[model samples]
Target: MDKDTKRDLHSLPKTLAELVGKHIVAAGLLVDEDPERAYKHAAYARRKASRLPTVREASGIAAYTVGKWQEALSDLRAARRMSGRDTFLAIMADCERGLGRPERALEITNDPAAKDLDADERIELRIVAAGARRDMGDVKAALAELQVPELKERRARPYVARLFYAYADVLEELGRKEDAREYFARASSVDREGVTDADERLAAIEGVELVDSDVEDGVVWTDVEEEADEAAAEAEATASRERRDDKGRDHRRDDRRDDRRGGREDRG
Candidate 1:
């Protein structure tokens, strides 16, 4: 429950406010772990508090997380109208792209407020707009769209790694392997939170096989190989547990059958 959400619920009756707040909190908590469940919770909250812009915003985000592109776009549009804020224009454009409407995505980017977005939101808009360009098979235009001054910055902001990663990915798509590799390394250097898989991209570019190791100096050391091995081990353990449970059930059945036979013999 953020301050904005609290303010939205301020006008509601106490009982309705509590219920909507619980649902919104549940949706927020589950959005990362189980997005489908998160969407359900957000939907419930929206149903209860349909007039609240914050509720619509939460539902829109939850819908996006679950890939319900049309629903997300609709909810986000409603949120924008109610709140008179265009903060989610990037997400709206992304939802249009998700629905396979690259032209519509481009159209959304033309909105006047799109230029007024904060730096991070502007970067996200550029990324999505670039993606839409790529979707339209104009890879050159896509490459051009991502060329911004922020890409040249050596200082690490949360969005910088992502920008570098996007640039690297596009370069790879254009068969500029050397340039792509350089940008990937740059992205990896600045990615303190492991937000992008820049390290994995770098490994692929250099043909470096990765293994499981402890994180050193903020670098994530895990690899797909280790993840595969863990998945296999878990599957084997599950099968073993099932086999033991089956065997135990069989043993109990045998004991019951023997006890019945002994009773019959005693009766005879």
Candidate 2:
């Protein structure tokens, strides 16, 4: 367990802590192989110890794996509120995307502490940010959002397979089939563990299902957004300012373009 998680669990009574700890361990172990079971374990842990931030975090991740968008979002938000450390910003943004509210996903990525994400987290955030653009029906802008220097690196970095896969997916959407094929090939080469269906995509055997999340801005608004922001605000109070997420979403030009289409805020 991570130090913060250990510390959080330490405050619980011994018997409850042991029970929660067992479920947490099981969830982590099965999350990759049997996410449904993992979610059950994590959910049980959360039910037993809803006040524990770590348990909530685990539950949120487990639910996210199973595509329970609203449940994941709510638990993650609770985790952030209880811990005052918002490490799941990217996940929360993805949950917004899963919930078909990509604009809100983009807005979540604009939190001041966004720049404090570590490398892998930054990449995840960038992916979600690009996905939000795609969801808004701006394929060109979506491509621009993923214009990070790491895209060119030869050395393997974490999440590089997913990065290549996302880029290829966008290229396919824009009718650049050749470019998409190239990226899918690259993704397949790196994805030894088959995290994505890049192999099937490269073989042209996978069904091409295009999901559209195009909605006019200002047409969709949730009353609960304010509460989420307030929770994030409280989280920012405890986030260490010393850390920095080296990558910034390199999409200023995208924002300029989006401004003409719709008023969307830009962040570094």
lDDT of 2 by residue, 27-105 (tens): 9999999999999999999989899889999999999999999999999999999888768999999999999999999
lDDT of 2 at 205: 26
Candidate 1: tens digits of C-alpha lDDT, residues 1-268: 8999999999899999999999999999999999999999999999899899999999999999999999999999999999999999989999999999999998897788978889889888889989999999999999898999899978777789999999999999999999999999999889887789998889898766556656665344445677788899999999999999999999999999999999999999
- TM for candidate 1 is 0.80
> Which residue runs does candidate 1 get wrong by more than 4 Å?
218-268
What's the lDDT for residue 216 in model 2?
48
Residue 191 accuracy (lDDT) in model 2: 74
Best by lDDT: 1
